[model samples]
Each structure stands twice: as structure tokens, then as C-alpha cells.
Target: MKNSRGSLVRPHPLPGSASRPVVTPLSPSVVYASDTPDALDDQYEGRVFGYTYSREGHPNGDVVAARLDEMEGASGGIVTGSGMSAVSAVLLGLLKQGDHVLGGNQLYGRSLRMMAEDLPRLGIDTSLADPCDVDAMRAAIRPETKMILVEVVSNPTLRVADIAGIAALAKESGALLVIDNTFTTPRAFRPFDHGADIVIHSVTKLLAGHSDVMLGYAVARDPALNDRLRVFGVTAGLTASPFDCWLAERGMLSFDLRFDRSQETAARLADHLAGLDGVKRVLYPMRADHPDHARAVQLLGDQGCNMVSFELTGGRASANAFTKAADGLSFAPTLGDVGTTLSHPASSSHRALTPDRRAALGISEGFFRVSVGLEDPDALLQIMTDAVAAARAAEG
Candidate 1:
């Protein structure tokens, strides 16, 4: 078979399979049979004869990782049980007791929590800096800092960081630059292009497109790091299920189409929301008034993924009213779904943080993060506008 570019491609088949079939969704197996003692020995030694056990390795996960590697321009990649697992594995695999990590203050709530609480328990120190402030990040770095971790586009707030600048700093500091590329998938931005040493993704989100599967991926620009991550994943039992890997691969097929549609809708909605009466602030990187607009254009170009965050003037009351009035839009805590959804940071993603911390991050009860879907932009805008008006009216 040949791809659209007319390059010859061979079918991916399982090693132990008798049939040379084109369409192969390799069955999930706990253990694979070894024909000979030599083959078993090779499997035990990690000689790559094929998967010996599902926990160590599997065909479905390998296929998905290979594809992610190709997309992200990574040397190697591994699939994990969840996004947090991918983050934890990479940190655990690379850093030791004395190592330090510099992370973005605006990271996902769970990530921040892990950095603040979990890494310290492992005897690793962490410092959180404003991702938008390169100087602050530089100042925060210590001699023991082994990794600089940040999201390509921050969660909830949608703040765009300077990946290239951070990468340069990390290189000079002898630290690895690790980016959570979950927001802008490889379709929109390849972290390697900006000198990221490692790229992480929550395949549960955009790559899966549909909200059905939970998977994570870590793609390494260095082969050694990749090997370390894989070993850590296998040893720690962080492997994703074969069925989820298979489903993720299938979802990746239409990722480009889904991404483009949702991104376009989000851009339009950001503009609409900016002018809406009840909206106090709109934070979309593509918007000219956004603080990181220039950086976003430099890094992501016009491809701003499906996220637009806005605040209501009436605080929590208006937000509650707006969500209640939004007929078709679901108030989902998650993002990257095909259907339009809204997430409340104060009550969901950022809920883990204290009220003071949430205030410090500019996340309030009025703030709402919208994950624009593949729905028609015009119709979605109308529904959103009506919802806002109703919310304001209710406040009056």
C-alpha cells in the first residue's frame, strides 16, 4: 500500500501471526508464546524479537509510539497509562535525589501539585516560575536543575510560553527542556523544531480527538532519554492498555481535520467573546490584545488549538447562569472533545489549588475555559452569545 504522497508502505503485522493481512488490530495479550528457548532468552534480554509480555512491551503500543515519533520528529517514543504517568515517568527516570526541576507556575493544577508535593517527597526540589517571563525562569534555575518543564500553551489561562528561549536556557544550564505538547499537538506545533529535548502529550486529548480513550505519550529527541523512559515505564507498570493504544491510533487518523476545524472555531469565538457584554476578559493567544500574541504567532503560527478562556463580569453568579443557559454546550471538566464543552477552572482543573493560589494565578469563580468543537462556528457563537446575555440578565 502507498500513502497519499505515493510512498510505498508495508502493512504492520504481528510477528507471531500466520496471516499476512493488511488490516491488523493485534489482539491484546498478557503474554506471548516463545517458540524456542533461544527466542525466550532474546525476549528476556530485550533483544526485540517481539513482545514477551504486555507490561514490558506490546505491538499496539509500539505502533502508536512509532507514529508519534514520526509526527513529533522524535528519536523514540513511549505510550503510558495517562498524561500524569508520562510526566511522572520522565521525571523519575531522568532525575535523581539531588536533582532540581524548574517548572511553569501556570501549569495544569495536577502537574503543579506533583511538582510542589510529590517531587519533594522523592528528595527532588522544584521551583515554579512564570513561563512567559524568561528572566524569571533563568533566575529560578539552580546548578542542580536537571529539567525545565512547561506546557507549550498553559492550561486554563492559555498562556503561551517562549519554548525557543527556554530551550536555549536549558541547553546553557545543562538541563533538558521538556514540554507538555498536549494543547498544540504535533499537527499544530512540533516541539523539536524549537529545541525541546522531550515532548509529552496526553493522547487522551487531541490525539484521541474523541473523549473515549485515556493514553499518554512521551517522545524523546535523544535516543538515550527514550530508552530511559521506556525502561522506567515498563518497570513502574505505567504502560497503556493495548486496546487504548489501538483506539488512539485510529483516532489519530482524523486529527488534522478535527484540529483545524476546532481551532478555527475557537479563534472566531475568542473574537466574539471579547466584544460580548458579560465577558470581562478573553484569553486566546491568537487575539491581538492577548499578552502572548506575538509569542504564540512565532511558535504556533495561526494554529491556535481549540481553547478559549473568558471571565464573566458578574463573577460566580454570572458564570453559573451562563452555564445553565448554554443549551447545547456541555459543562465538561475535560477538553479536546469533538462536541463543544466548557470547563470551570475554579471548580475543576485549578480546584486543587488554594483560593489564594487560584487568585494569584488570576483564575476566579467567573473564569470559564471553552473547548470549541467541530460544530459550525456561526451556530456555536450564537448559542454562546445567547447564553452570555441570559447570564447577564439573570444577574440584573
Candidate 2:
């Protein structure tokens, strides 16, 4: 369940957690798990560029950041309280108020809003366009375009942006290409290898695998850029809890293995849903019909990530009924959990935008976002199939 307070993670059996002593919330020092060494050789030692505070760095957070940097093949990395914080901190760190951000039009609702609503208030200028539209991206560049931002795979719509193409444009224009890798976590897509200057993640979803934590990260292939972002991360006070970072660390170990299964299941579900009636469009990576399917395959390779989004033939009413029929699925927003979760883009994640603005961005009322999970695919298909049937029955 999710309220404004954020998501409530469903509990499952956590791995390697037997005989682990728990820390009471009563102390300045807290330990979430055992088998890990204490963070500081001298907790009070005054170290430079090292963990001076939890807001700056924590043992678990540094460990997790190191692991993610290795996984993504980044020279450096920083973790944040949430995914938005990661993007915000990096942008604020790299660009001043007058700097411009060229962002994808089909970004996650909040991400797009950050460009349209928040950044402007900071006296920053931004332009939204299809990052895959190479020519537009080229033409939109100004002397002030500091960052060209895109998601490896977009939310709800599953629109695959051409990471390499955008990267090329960014370089040609002397701007940095920032890729949001939440959907294509390091387990699947390594953006830095594709010329991305920076890679960001909403670790709360996939990286934290079990969905028990809220965290975000920004990784840089260049140490200089990483240092700049790190300073902003610290000064801005955007930091993940040490315990949450520890949870994310444990989640990191099984990333490649977990995402492999999840992506396979997602493709299966997409195929099943695509074949069924009352379906308007199926938006999974590598589909011939998708706008950027081929490019996605070329850049993202065989691991298409775990998201599968499609549209209902009957529009909003059908979309609503389908979601309602998915009773066992986690229907409240956020994705990247161990179990299957579904959402309606227009009404939920993108509700902050005006109807016309959402429609302008291709977020129709019929759009549905599904995140595949560690479940029996056949059972998952049945549940979704039933949702389609309910939508059809409601249409009648």
C-alpha cells in the first residue's frame, strides 16, 4: 500500500539473516545486520573525503555505492534518499540556475515535472523532447544545454531511448548525457559503457529488490564529475539511511540473477498480453512495432529489463477495470519489487500532469505499466488474463 508517506514494503524471507542482532532506534550508532565489519576503524576519527556523517557517507552506503559502481563500471558513485534526489542532486551540482536541461518527453511523471515545474523555479531552463529524436536533440542544443537527460527505459510506457545516439549528440554538442537506469538497473544495462556521462538509479525499486527500502544513486564514469556530484550530495543533505543502504547491499548480490529471471518472465507476460484480445498496443522492448525497439536491442542487448507496458482497447474505462481485476497484484504505484506490481499511468504515476499534457506525451488513459517479478509466469499470466476479461465484461 502507498500513501503520500511513501510505499509500505511487503515482507518476504530475507536471505542470510538468522541470528542477526537488532539495533534499537535509541542510539546514535546503529547496526542493521551482522557479518559486516564496523564502518570506521575509529568512529570519531576525522577523515577527509571519507564518511564524516551518515548524511555524507555511511559504511553500508559506501559499500553499496562501491558495489554499484563496479556493477555499472563507473569510476565513482553516490547514493541518495530516493531516485529523484539522485537526479536533483546531480543536476543541481553540475548546473547552476541559468543552465539548461534537455530532458526526455516521455520521462517518469515526477521526472518530467521536475524539469517542467521544479527546475524552472530554481531559475533553470529546460526543454522536453524525444531523446531518441536525434535531429531534434541536435537542434535543441544551446550553449547553455548542460545536460541531456534520458531514461534507459521509460516508466509506464516502456519507451526505450537510444542511449548511444543521445550520448553521441551530447558529446557533439559538448553537453553531458545523463541516463536514468532505474528501469535498466546495472544487472541488465550498463549505461556508462555506452558513452553515458552519468547513470542514475531509483534503487528503491529494483536495486533494493525486496522493496523494503527507499534509495537512489548517481554514478559517474569520470572522477571529476563524480567529485562535484558528491559535494552536492553531501551539502544538499540527500543521503540514504545506513540500514536502508545495508538492505540495498544485500539486494545487490542477486541483481543479475534476479533480473535475468524477471526479464524472461516479463517478455513472456508481454507476449501473452499482446496476443489476447481487448489489447490496443503492447510496449515491451524488442517488439518490432515499438518506436525504438531495434535501437533498444542494439544498446540494451538481450536483457530488455523487467518492465512491460501496453494499452487497453477500450481506453480509460477498460484500463480502470483491468487494474481493478488485478486484485492480487500491488496496484498502488512504485515498481521494482520481488512480486508482480501493476499501475495505470494516466491516473496514478502521471496524475500530476494535466490531462492534455499527459495526452500530449502519449500517456493515454488506456496505458498500463506492469513490472514482472519472481513469480510463476503461468500464474501471473492467468491473473492478468482475468483482468483483461474483467475489462471486456465491463466494456459490455
Candidate 3:
């Protein structure tokens, strides 16, 4: 069962059956009633029994994991209960006591807190550097640093990191490069192409597309690392439910179509926002004026993601007015949904950070995060424009 490319292809009856319903049920356990005692023993020992336990592995979870591994160009991968759990599994499974981790200052708020607060309590030290600055990242690395954690695109501001350069630096220093590829899905950017050792994704976002499933994944370039992560997942009971895995897989089937449409709309919206009167700044990698525009083109080519963040001239007052008056857009603290939505970082994702820390990351009281969706671009723009006008009137 090998493809023309010499890659082993999973057999067609698909391992789980091709004729069955698309939505697989929650298989708590499977009993091989037809098998003899000797056959059962062999099956269990070979890990082919399908379902001895739900936490260790299941057919639905296996299918999704294989698909994700293939998509991310990784040796293997595991699904976790939530995106943060996937992040935790990788950090905890790989690092030991006394190990140091260098992380990016632009990481999602919860991720930053985990590295700064949680790791320190476990005797593992951590430091944060601006990943956009390769020199700053290199200067922060120490001999004890076993891993360097960074998001492919910084949240809120959408700062792009130089993956290939950072990967080379990590290899030279004998450190693993772990990238959180949640913002940019595998369709747009595959970290492994740039020599990343590990890539993480929050399936709750663009992968799931609807924001209904809470799931995360860790894909490892090294098979040994993949095994370690799987073991950690089982031991910690962080494995995502089979039902959620199935839902995520279903959502992922349309990822290419959804992302393409949403991204097109996002690019149009970015340009429109930049021209609006109340908008102080528009932060999107595809925008020519973005600080990382060149790096983004180098790493992501023409595929800019659906996220757009902009600052309002009237601060929090304008932000509040715009969100409150905006029609056809919902106010959700999450991103990557089928319908466009907005989030206020000062109160949601980055709220845990101190005001000064938020300011340092360029997350102002007026900053607004837009998760573009599969909608008519012209209609979305009109709604946004009207909202801005309302916001400006409120400021007056």
C-alpha cells in the first residue's frame, strides 16, 4: 500500500470502514468477541485492538492524528483536550527539572503565563524575547535552554517570525524549535518546511472553523518526540474525546476553501480599515506597511491568514461603540469562526497581563482583533464602515 511517491498510504476501506456514517460515534471500548484468546492477546500486545481504553487511543482519534501529521509534514502527532493542553504536553513531556526555555514575548497571554508562572514553580526557568528580532532571541538563549517556544504569528498584532532563521539558530544551539502554528493553519504555513522540530495547532480555531470543538494538536518531526508526547497525553489524561476529534476532522475537510475565502476578505478589510477615519493602525501581515511584510512574504508567500487587528483613535470608548453598533458581527473572545467576529484583547485574551505588559506588546485599550470569516467582502466592509462612523460620533 504505497503511493507513487513511495509513501505508505493507508488502505482504502480506510481502517475505520468507508460505508459507515460520516459522523462516528464515541467508541468507549471495542470487544473482539469473534477473536480467540490467543488472537486477542496478540492484538492487545501489538496495539491493534482498536479500543482497549479511550484515553490511550481510539479509531476516531487515530484518523484525525494521521491526517494532521500528514498535513503538518510531521512524523506523528497527538490530539489534546484543548490548545493549552497541547502546549502543556509538549513543554512538560520534553523538558525536565532545571531545564531552561526561551519563549517569545508575543505569545498568546495564557501561553506566556504558563511559561512565566507555571514553569518556574516546577523548577524550570523561562525567558521571553521578541522573536521578530533574531538577535534578541539568540542573546536570550542559554546552554540550559532545551527549547525555544514561539508563535508563528504574534497574537493581536500579527507579527511574523523568521522561522527558518530561528530554526537554524535552535539547531546550532542544540535546542528544539517549537512553533505554535495556531494563527496560520497548515494550509498557509507548514513549519516543518522551515526546519521546525515541532508544530502546535489549536483545532478550536481555524482547523475546526466553527469554533465548536475544543481541541489541540502537537506534531513532531522526530518520531521519538511524538512517542513521548503520546505517552504524556495518556498519563496526564489530556487526550481529546473521540467525538470532538471526529467533529474537528469534519471541520477540517473544508479548511482550504474556508481559509481561502476568509483570507481574501481579510485582505480587502485590512485595506478598507486603513482608509477609515477612526482607525489609527491596521496590522495584517499582507499589508505592505506591516513591519514584517517582507518576512511574511518569505515565509507565507501570498497566503495571509484571516486575522486582522486594528487600533482605534478614540481608545476603549471607540472600541466599545464600534463593537456595540456593528451589525452582522458578533462579539466573541475567540477567532477563526465561520462568521466574522471581534475580540477586545484588553478584556479577553491579553487581560491577564499587567497594563504595562499589554502596552509593551502594543495591545492598547483601543486595539480590536477581527477574525474574518466566509462572508461577502463588500457587505462586511459596509458594516464595519458604519460601525466606525458610529464610534466616531460617540467620541464627539
Two-way lDDT contest, 2 vs 3, winner: 3
lDDT of 1 by residue, 259-325 (tens): 9989988989999999999889999998989989999999888887899999888777888899998
lDDT of each model, Cα atoms only? 0.89, 0.81, 0.89
The CA lDDT at 284 in model 2 is: 86
Q: What total of clashing residue pairs does each candidate reach?
A: 0, 0, 0
Query: What is the Å distance of residue 357 in model 2 from its true position?
Result: 2.5
Question: Per-residue lDDT of 7-47 in model 3, one digit per residue for the tens?
Answer: 54632332665587756565545322424667767766885
10 residues in a row with least lDDT, candidate 2 = 24-33
Per-model C-alpha RMSD = 7.2, 8.9, 7.7
| Model 2 agreement with the true structure over 265-293: per-residue lDDT tens digits | 99899889988888888988867777887
- Candidate 2's TM-score: 0.87
User: Alpha carbon lDDT of residue 290, candidate 2?
Assistant: 78
Which residue pairs show backbone clashes in model 3? none
Ordered list by lDDT, greatest first: 1, 3, 2
Pick by TM-score: 1 or 3, better one = 1
